[model samples]
Target: MIHIYLCEDNNRQLTRWKSVVEKYLLMNSTESQLYCTANSPDELLEIRKKSTVTGLYFLDIDLQSEKNGIELAQEIRKYDPRGYIVFVTTHSEMAVLTFQYKVEAMDFIVKDEIETLPDRICACIKNAEVKYKTQLDSSSRLLSVKVDKTSLILDQDDIVAITTCEDYHKIMIHTKHGVRQMSGSLKELIAVLNPAFCQCSRSAIVNMKHVVKYSREEALLTMDNKETYSVSIRMLGKIQRALKQL
Candidate 1:
């Protein structure tokens, strides 16, 4: 299920957005639900921590927090890079920083324009519903990996992990298809990988989608196929943050 998250500190503005979003979802018959309306970034993050699902975020720029909406989007990306993020702000001057953040923001709406605010918000949600549907229909994304000697193409979604083999100056690409030793480094391999692939260590990178179990006791990550990888204690923090929560 798709969830909508709204974070606005102002109670009156929050109520207005909530009403519009509720109406939009009902009118379009979108199964998506407005999960929570938050007055702070922490509140929204807490709600997401409890549920693992596709999400659309509409955040106000100035939350009066040290970390603003842009930073909130960055934090959300740690767990869900594919989640749609739209910034809602009263100040238009802050709009220029959206591109600088590289959060793949869908749209920026200025709240001062009360007349057009609902229309803009409705449009972004409608477009997001279409985009999320297309992603669901495809299920998996594909990528081509090129090496000096051979070219290999595979489903990026099937990848379990990519690790550096220092001996051969190559990368051991592990996928559901099986392991393939390709001439590449984690640095080079990561450049082509999708956001689902996260660097757990200087040597290892794992596809968060394939991590079925993570053991803090053993500092190990168990894959869907039951293959286990020892996660470095230092990188464990980042690995946990990037991994999808149940």
Candidate 2:
């Protein structure tokens, strides 16, 4: 389901835009389930921190607060890098400012051209949905591990186990060539992967797809590679539940 967030401060404008968006969605039979409205950057940040959003944002470039919509978009990118951002503004010149945020904004709808705004927004939403789906299909979760000065993309399925060595976490991948060493933090790596990957222990996050069998009593995970890894007692139930879903 798509989760749309509208951050417009003007009550009348907000109502008009909301109606436009809702009408477009209904006409197209869009599968948007959650719609959040915020008047300020602070409110947007709060909603972003608490919610798992997966759709377009119709943000006002000029807000009534200290921080503007561009600043809020930068903050949103930190957590949700894939969300579609669009600027709704009175000043068309502000379009260049989007490059500073490094956000691939779908479009900038000029408030003066409010008559055409609904059609423009509808097109952007459809485009964003297509791009989002394509990304999900083409990309598997990659754990980037820095080996010396170079970084490599380690597929989650290729990982056998993780072990920490001093400050860095060593990732062991069962490649067609052999096992290889790549460095990263287990905590940071987990954030990029799907939540379905459960931590067997402090050092290892066994991919749910690779787990062939799990022992709750011993807190152990046996992968499809026939290698066994120990899970901490605290994570036993999580591992068991993840394995069951397979």
Candidate 3:
């Protein structure tokens, strides 16, 4: 689901942009939940505070409020760093201010050339999805695992490798002092992780961040600790692509 926010002061332009965005979403077979705010930066900020946005934003520079769209964008970034922001304005000169908010702003669009605006917004949303997934995976949550009747809350990031054993899997995690082992099945353990941690073999689903080297010919993954695990030939390409993104 994509949540889009539009901040435009002009009634005519706001309606037109909303129509264009709706058409684009319909054509792409995607559902968009849109929040429209006209000329009010305070209302826009309030909407953001109440919503969990996952998509792009179309903001107008010449807002009716004292704070322009650029200033509101900086404020938005404080809470939602992953949302895509596109500034829309009649004044092309305001494009220079993009440098100040480039970290949050994905692109700037001229109001007259609104024909090309939908494509840019769609592209930015796609890019944001990829980045959002990466960020979510990098910040894996802690989980408690029971091994031989002993329960432990393991830091997911400390996990170096995981391998299946009969009906269970052995998880090798690196602590500040040394490595420790926990028991669980690949399927059971994998459900707790994001897509970034992919299965490289029938017996193993390794953390992409822990992978330091890989050999397609040898069908193996070498972790930062110098331990090598066998990678199935069929899953090698998938593992390689995932690692390359890192």
Predicted model with the maximum TM-score: 2
Taking the tens digit of each residue's C-alpha lDDT, what string does model 2 give over 99-199?
97687787889988867888887787778766655565476644455666664444454455555555454655453224655666677767777665777
Candidate 2 stretches greater than 4 Å from native = 140-246
lDDT-sorted candidate list, best first: 1, 2, 3
Cα lDDT tens digits for candidate 1, 1-246: 468999999999999999999998766644467998999999999898886667899999999998899899999998788899999998778777878988988898989899999999999888887787667547645455665554444556667998888676788878664677777678877886777887877788898889888888988888886777887878887788887453
TM-score of 2: 0.58
How many residue pairs clash in model 2? 0
Task: Tell me the lDDT of model 2 at 183.
Answer: 64
The Cα error of candidate 1 at residue 170, in Å, is 55
Each candidate's TM vs. the true structure? 0.57, 0.58, 0.52
Which segments of model 1 are wrong by more than 4 Å? 140-246
lDDT of each: 0.82, 0.72, 0.70
- TM-score, cand. 1 vs. native: 0.57
Return the clash pairs for model 3, or none: 169-184
Best by the lDDT measure: 1
